[model samples]
Target: MHRIVIAFLLSSLSGLAFAHGMSAEDQARILNAGLLEYMQLGATHMLSGYDHLLFLFGVVFFLTRFKDILKFITAFTVGHSITLIVATLLEISANYYLIDAVIALTVCYKAFDNLDGFKRYFQMSSPNLTWMVFAFGLIHGFGLSTRLQQLPLGTDGLVLKILSFNVGVELGQIVALSIMLVILAGWRKTASFERFSKASNIGLMLFGGLLLLMQLHGYQHTQFPDEFPLNTDDHFHIHEDMEAETSPLTNYPNKLNFDDIYSQDEVLHDDNSYQDEHSHDGEDFHSH
Candidate 1:
């Protein structure tokens, strides 16, 4: 059972660390799509969003009580929903890679907390779990907002569309959480669960670290592209070379000028015709 949990977490994180948001076609669909379509996009995004799922799993890892789950999830939802709406509406946005980097860290943070890293490493107590989760949710919402902003959301019926999308995200969350809870419940019944709980959370922390590194690397590439070993300068030089090589004048500099050559031919033809006419007149005069 614990084996299943570890495998599931690892596989999900591995996928999440590299997954992109939506495709161009999906973004195009959002341009003229209705509320239901937007809703579907939101639902699909959440369902496929491994980073979000892992963090959520970390959040509910030890919470056996239904009320606690409700409280924590609600706090998280409210926090993210506010920013998702407000940020997109007010046009408040940030670099998504950076936002995602922080989001990845949240997974690490939750996993570390789950394993009591603070007590073990620093001999300190953690903060209020509810408030911290809410805070992290705010950050998560900003990430969501960045994705929504990529869509061509027009002025008309924008609020309704955002609301619908939020609803869909919640729906997706519910479905995912249900499955996770069932898995956890089953694992709890097994005797090995207690033995492996620490290891599982440790695994979660490792996954989070990988995600964090990926996000930071992405951020670095976006911010300082030239720092990478791959020669981007070559790309620019190749473009310039192509432009120069493809120029008409550059390719045929030694070729004769067609306009000038045609003008010269016409002038020579006129001169020959005038000489021939005069010669014909002379011949007629001599014959007479």
Candidate 2:
């Protein structure tokens, strides 16, 4: 089935994030990370990152000019790369599970655009989906950095490591886009192009929608650092608990089920166990 193929593709990318591919014994080597490794990681993540690739594909899917694509890509690159580096440098990062969940939603956004969801729903053009995609790119960049940090590569070349990874990402993206452009152009040359265009975009939108929904309920209690009390840097630290408004299912609903779910260790332990199972899957789907 189509879902199987897409699932396989995503799993293939995540598999490449294995730290075992490097050296586990070199944990002490702070300067061990090199250009070659970052290059490999960058290229690997870009291609393997089904969500990221789909986002980029959606962003440039409409633009027909090289310069325009570069401009758009540049905006997105800057937005995300800034946060990615800062996350590692200042140790300021968002919840890993939540960010990824949002990235999945972005894929759905693009697919929805392809299917003309916006026009049918909002019927507006001034504030389009491009800006939304760019904002999501910021989150996506952090997602990339998070995966990179998980690797054993020495942080000594932290700057270089991040930079090299960014470059490799762009390189890989160019390669993917080039092929896609060729296919689109060729398709345009055909007579049935117009007939199939809507369907193709719809397929992309459908894929995006599926990714979005998958990530929303990925974890039952999407806990992260909360920005309540100020930190030593005079800046509030918003760790895993930053998503307060949206995580009612985990926090609010629990208040309602305080007796049933969180009544005692015997009850709470089982509830935690169930949540852990859902969190491990890292995606959620609930019936309204």
Candidate 3:
């Protein structure tokens, strides 16, 4: 069940490989200048990152208790923060796809654990899952920081900018978590919670699987997304002058009424002398 959900999500994400975001070079330019850009990076990274948000959604879904949520989230936060800072400051790097692939697996692992699949399917011991979660988080953090580093960073105030951006990421996560909690709590009040809940878990599993495969696809092509969904096209071009169907352009083909593309004077003056007749008729019409 969770697998199905994961599949759909990953399908959507698989487009990530081809789905354009800030290029590493472009991101470096943004990273180098202005506090505004730095702050925006934090917000943008969180906003644009589907994988991060999906994992976060999985993390918070089952947590109804505040203390428990705080505890686990704090651990995850600490893990990410440590690496994000260290990675950016120390300039350590790793392959993006592998890290992202692991991150996708983290989503799968967490969702599966939440579903208690291990206890049911394998009858095997899965110990210290939180620790595992934290470790994976470090990997995810490194992936993000590496992307940030790809942007050119002048030695001037680099540390401060990265710190500020990371802070923004934390803030964005908090906001996202709060919203998810509010929505999930509201949903729990309804009767469908039990009936559809397993299905939802299945969805998460599927999303994770797709992301994992999608990342793998990118590794194969360097254009891999972190999830699955075979895509047709992400962008389109338009030419206003041509008809969309026959002309192979984006615009409607008005019948070759070249006269329509004329100046006011040209339009008013015709070889048939209709313009002269119309002008004479206009004065009469006005008088009437």
Per-candidate clash tally: 0, 13, 24
| Candidates, ranked, TM-score | 1, 3, 2
lDDT of prediction 1: 0.88
* Model 3 root mean square deviation, Cα atoms: 10.2
Q: Which candidate achieves the best lDDT against the true structure?
A: 1
lDDT of 1 at 46: 91
lDDT of 2 by residue, 88-149 (tens): 66656565666777777777677666666767889964355456656876888888767666
TM-score, cand. 3 vs. native: 0.69
* Top-scoring candidate (TM-score): 1
Model 1 TM-score (2 dp): 0.78
Clashes of 1: 0
- lDDT by residue for model 3 (1-288), tens: 333434535654655655324576566567446876776678767756777777877787778888978877887888888899998999898768777888888888878877888889999777685787688778778877877776777788988888887887887788767766776777777776777677777777787888888778777665445354444443233343234556644465755556566765565555435523334655653211
Query: Could you arrange the candidates by lDDT from highest to lowest?
Result: 1, 3, 2
* Reference-based TM-score of each model: 0.78, 0.62, 0.69
Better of 1 and 2 by TM-score: 1
